[model samples]
Target: MELLPFDEYVRSLDRKRMSAGVLFRDAEGRVLLVEPSYKAQWEIPGGSVDAGESPWAAASREVREELGIERVFTRLLVIDYVPDDGRMPEGIAFVFDGGLITNAEVAALELTDPEIVSAGLFFLDAVPSLKATLAARLAIALRAAQAGEPLLSENGTELT
Candidate 1:
């Protein structure tokens, strides 16, 4: 039997999509969510990770692009592995801790990206209005952030 060339072997492996998001909270503990112009369900500030971009960089870039604010997130809150749904491919999502933003910072946010229509802080209970998977992911991520520990989840359910 002959082994495939290194490059050929690499290309044969399945490629999974990746996305990174930043979980920002207010002093009152409400999570910041963005309403995308193309989607009815609101989500956190984030988007797909570029091919060559690190998850941290992707999260920071998404925040800056969507909210027009520069924030460096150093702590990762949750890593979720989502299965492929009919609309999207299977992927891994990284949620970073944006800590707490002040009221002034919230007021100063500019929706620089046309894709994002609005931004607001919402209580955890209200996040259920988002896609079910995303809502579960955010709830776990928020808990992980508050607990000062990172969590692992699959399809929005926490892994033991």
Candidate 2:
């Protein structure tokens, strides 16, 4: 029996990019959003999961790297499978709860990463207006928040 070459086998599978992020809310339940210098719209605090990294770990690392804050995630919120768009390869996206934050915690946030321009809180209802993709993802997050359970989604629609 002959086995396929390693490179050939690997190349046969679709490549996807994995990313992880956390959602933080203020006492009023406003969601925390960050303006990425590279993107036209704001995003939540998180980034791509590095090789050999767990989604949870990547989410924590992204928050620390981007916002210069150390916070524990409360629980898994959503796992979304985004299809590949022309501009980006599709992959699984994870959202975890960074838990509630106070005004002091918000003030303590620093944009240490060059990619982050600023961070602010916005009403959950306002998230969809930020960007097309954000609207979809936020929908799932909102459901997760309400149900207090992990949700599976595709692009932004929650899977039953």
TM-scores, all models, native as reference: 0.92, 0.85
Model 1 ranges off by over 4 Å: 1-3
True-vs-predicted CA distance for residue 59, candidate 2, Å: 0.4
Error of 2 at 93 (Å): 0.8
Question: Model 2, range 55-129, lDDT digits (tens) per residue?
Answer: 888998899899987766759989999888888888999999887777777777878799998888888667533
Give the alpha carbon lDDT tens digit for every residue of 1-160 in model 1.
9999999999999999999999998878788999999978899999999999999999999999999878787799999999999989999999999988876777788887999988888887776358888888988998898789999999999997
Q: Give candidate 1's whole-model lDDT.
A: 0.90
Give all candidate RMSDs, comma-separated.
Answer: 1.6, 2.7
lDDT of each: 0.90, 0.83
Q: Which segments of model 2 are wrong by more than 4 Å?
A: 1-11, 72-74, 127-129
Error of 2 at 11 (Å): 5.5
Which TM-score value belongs to model 1?
0.92
Q: How far in Å is the alpha carbon of 121 misplaced in model 2?
A: 0.6
